[model samples]
Target: MAPARKKVVIEGSVSCVYCVMEGGPGSVIKTDLLPGAVVKLQCNNSRKGSWEEQTKTGGKGDFSFTPVKVSSRGAHKCRVFLVSSPRGVCPLIISDGAVLKPAPPNATSPFQLFTLQPLYFYPAPYTCL
Candidate 1:
């Protein structure tokens, strides 16, 4: 008598670009959503309280969920409540299976550069497949 375990379903989603840049995924949003557009992937591991999973949006703007797995991992989040691009909630680029830090120096927001030959290392474009 031992057959009941399907709790470890921690799927999440909503990583978007909606279009106007022609980058990678689907790139074309002037207000056209119909590939799987329902838009709602609210998740919560901690940012406030209550928000298990809702799941929608799959037209390249994507959304997914299957939560039930929890052992206090640290942090987890997923949100995509669309309007035009970003309004209510949206956050899921995924990087929590492992390797959470050591890759956070690609920072560039508006402008901030002052290097006279001291520190600004750049060699990891994609070299550790």
Candidate 2:
């Protein structure tokens, strides 16, 4: 007989801060806002539903997704992907391995909330032709 699997829910937020400084002279700084950016979640187990699900950032660059079912035997892994950027500035997913703690059989939430690492954007140096 096979053992029963547990239900789990995963959620997190995506946000970034853009800053600009003076090329020379003094230090003049400015922060650019990121909103409406598309982010996708990748799940190892397909039974939880579609492996490729997407969501968008809110006005404050916050995003989350629906819950998913995880396997009991193995450590389930899910990766975050960047679909598109509103300002044409794509950021990299720097989050390391995020492991979810198994839920209790009679758990109320049966879920885990992880803190996603910040996405960083590095400007490319320019050279005049």
TM-score of each: 0.20, 0.54
Best by TM-score: 2
lDDT of candidate 2 vs native?
0.49
What would the per-residue lDDT of candidate 2 be over residues 1-129, giving only the tens digit for each residue?
864554444444444434424352122233344578777766776455546577888887767655444444432566666666676443433444344443444544444344454343322221111
Q: Each candidate: RMSD to true structure?
A: 17.4, 7.2
Where is model 1 poorest over a 10-residue stretch in terms of lDDT?
114-123
Top-lDDT structure, candidate number: 2
Candidate 2 least-lDDT 10 residues: 120-129
TM-score, candidate 1, is: 0.20
- Tens-place lDDT per residue, model 1, 33-106, is 22332343344555465554344455554443334433213223443343233322212222222211111222
